[model samples]
Target: MAGNFKMLAKTFYGFEPILAKELRDLGAGHVKEGVRNVTFEGDTGFMYKANLCLRTALKIFKPIATFKVLNEKELYQNVNRINWPKYFDCGKTFAIDTTMHSDVFNNSLFVSQKVKDALVDKFRAVERQRPNVNTHDPDVRINVHLYKNFCSVSLDSSGSSLHQRGYRIATNIAPINEVLAAGLLLSSGWDGETDFMDPMCGSGTFLIEAGMIACNIPANINRENYAFMHWNDYDDELHNKIVDASLNKTREFHYKIIGYDKAPSAVRKAQENVDNANLSEYISIERKDFFRTEKPIDAKLHMVFNPPYGERLQIDVEDFYSKIGDTLKQQYPDTNAWLITSNLEALKYVGLRPSRKIKTYNGKLESRLVKYEMYAGSKKAKFNPDGQEAKS
Candidate 1:
């Protein structure tokens, strides 16, 4: 606890609690869940581990300064007070990202511009040289957040986004984000206890993420870049040590992790991604129509997928959803099926009541992650006299 400091992990709307649990499990202190983010205390090594191990985090930030401001001048002065030269060199390009929810500052762009000016001004006054702004792809990313009259400035430790896990070299037309896929799998209570599946896998995002989770593998193990790596005080030896320590924590996965995509191209891409992640040993990708296929094995299966919502793929909504319902009820016995879709009206045509319905968002559209429990033989007779689920 000598050098432990507060850090924040940014996540999706319904994933704060999951991220908080991840932080706590990773030995973080003072873990607290906030809206779309989780705050915790850790040292520099812990920061590296958090960025590498956290599955649901989009970005990890280290707060540098916090102050109260009412206007642009106050914001500029407060930002300028920080020692910018100590964080990154002037040779490295930097970018400022500002998010504001205040009456005084109405425009986020204006706020970012002011902050950028302050940073460049301070560097020029002290070092006589300014770090050029690289909005496209900056080596250093600075985060500015304003709530009411309070402003907090932090260094974005993770560049781009943690969802770019580096294993997914190939992708389909409408591929699900890696972080969202991982969050959905975690939300569905997948623990590698049973056979896992994604009937509508696109580019194998869910399958790879599922395999990684099932094996206790780090989320960003394949990733080679981070904003912190570009900082002046970055410790390569400590980072490598953390990486090795995290890798040593991985456990074996016995059950199968399978994926299905009807499209031939999707199957190839998914297989390519699975191999890229070195998860081919634990996962299988096949080109098969899910509606025409039954469960691969005679065991309880954990299923999660994101089917078309009648928006992109031209298909009959009613017929497709009805077929999905019929297949699960008639073929997939002793299984827990979960799917997320924005087509709420189409979801009703499935004709099966969801055991659990959770409100979630997919990118910008509102969606629901619903679960359907398929019994072995009959709903009332879930267990036979032998205390086992009756199989047809």
Candidate 2:
């Protein structure tokens, strides 16, 4: 508790609660959920752990300054007042990202330009040299957020978004994001209690993430980079200690994580990704159409997948969803199936009303994560047309 500071973990929409729970479980203090982010208290070592372990976090930011700004001049002066040289060296490349939700600034780009000018001017006046801007891949990333005239400037600790978990080397046409996959699994209450399956696993993101969660493995175990690594006060020894501590917490997972893909190419790519993540021991991939195969295990199964939303894949959306419903009803008994899709109209054809429908986003497209329950014996004996259970 010597150097405890507040940190914010950004996540996708509707993932605030799940991300908050993840932070709390990781021993964060005073964890609070915001719109699409979570705020918590942690020290420098904990920050490294959060960056390396939080599966739902997009980026972890350490806020250095907060103020009320009435105009552009005030923003520049306030940002310039901070000791920019203390955070990073002049030789390191940096990038400024601005997000505005206020009428005071019509263009976010203009705000970013002003902030950059202030930072560079501060560095030039103090250190006699300015850090060059590298928008493509920066060593340092700064975030400026404005909401209703209030400005919060933070230093981004995680670069390139935490979704780039480094395990997914091969990608399919529209592979689900690793963060999104992990969030969905957590949202579905997956605790490694039973066997897991991703019937239409593309690039095996869900399988890899599920395996990590099951085994308590650090989310970024395969990741090699973080913006904090370029900071002036980066302590390699502290970071390594944190990594070893997290690795020491790893537990054994007894269940299987299975993936199936109809396309041979997708199966190969998913297997490659699984191997890349070093999860091949827990996850097994096969080239088999999900609709044609019954449940591989008789015990209760947990399923989460992103079926082709008919975006890049050539298929009849309505018929495909119908077959999905039919197959789940006819084959996969005693299973809980969840899928996310942006095609709402096509989703209606699934016939079985979802027991739960959560509004979420897949990238920029608004989507729904729905759950369908398959009974063990007779499907009609338990589920009604409305997705509710039938009376005894």
Candidate 3:
């Protein structure tokens, strides 16, 4: 507890509780949930572990300093007082990102500029040379969040977004974010309990993430770097030990994880990504239109996918949705299918009343994760096409 510091893990909206649960499970102390973020206590080593292991976190930030500032001068002074030399060297590159909800700082760029100036000034004063600022790819990334009069300065432990899982080399036009993919799968209560399928598997994110969850694999086992590796106090041996320990905890998964994509390119990309993630043993990708393929496995199948939303892909939204519904209703019996889309108007064409519909945001678009339950065998079922019960 002596070295433990408060940390925040940023996430998407409606994912705070899920992230909090993850932090608590990973032995974080005093875990608390905020809007689109979760705060917890951990040490430097745990920071590295969190960056490596957390599946739902977009970024992990370690707050180095907090202060009260009413104006720009105070902001600069507060940031300058920190011991910058203790964090990185003058030869290292750095970048600053700022977010503010305060009236004092009108522009986030100005705040970032001030923080950068303070850091460069400190380095110049001590070593006579400042760390070069590299906004594109920095050795160190700093985050400043100003709310009202409170300013919090944090070092970004995850250099890039955790969504860059190091496995996805090929992507389709509208590939889903890895964090969102993992979160959506978890939200659907997918613990690899049974056979899993992604009917419209683009890039196979869901299939790979599901395999990792099923096997208890570390989320970033394939990732080669983290921002903490550049820190002065980073312990390579300790980090390696943590990696070994996390890998040792991996469990056996005995269920089938399959993916199908209509586009041949998508299937190729998905297969390539699955191989890159080292999950080829657990997953299989096929080039077949979901509407034309029948259920491969007879056992209970859990499905999650994002079809062409008509936003970019030129397709008849209503007819495509109707075909999806027809495929599920006629072919995919004994399955719980879940899909997410921003096209609310076209959702009606699905025909089946969603058992559950939850409003969520995918980036700036308002989206819904809807679920439909198709019972197994001999059970007479009918889809309501009157469009009466489908609620937003």
Candidate 1's C-alpha runs over 4 A off are 378-392
TM-score of 3: 0.95
Compose the digit string of candidate 2's lDDT tens values, residues 261-375: 9889999999999999998899999999998999999889999999888877878998999999999988898999999999998889998989999999999999999999987
Against the true structure, what is each candidate's TM-score? 0.95, 0.95, 0.95
- Flag regions of model 2 displaced more than 4 Å: 379-392
Q: Write the per-residue lDDT of candidate 3 for residues 247-366, one digit (tens) a residue.
A: 999999899999998789999999999999999999998888887888997899999998878887879998999998999988888999999999998889999999998777777888
Q: Between which residue pairs do clashes occur in model 1?
A: none
Sort all candidates by lDDT, best to worst: 2, 1, 3
Q: Worst lDDT window (10 residues) for model 1?
A: 375-384
Off by over 4 Å in 3: 378-392
The lDDT, on a scale of 0 to 1, for candidate 2 is: 0.93
At residue 369, candidate 3 shows an lDDT of: 91
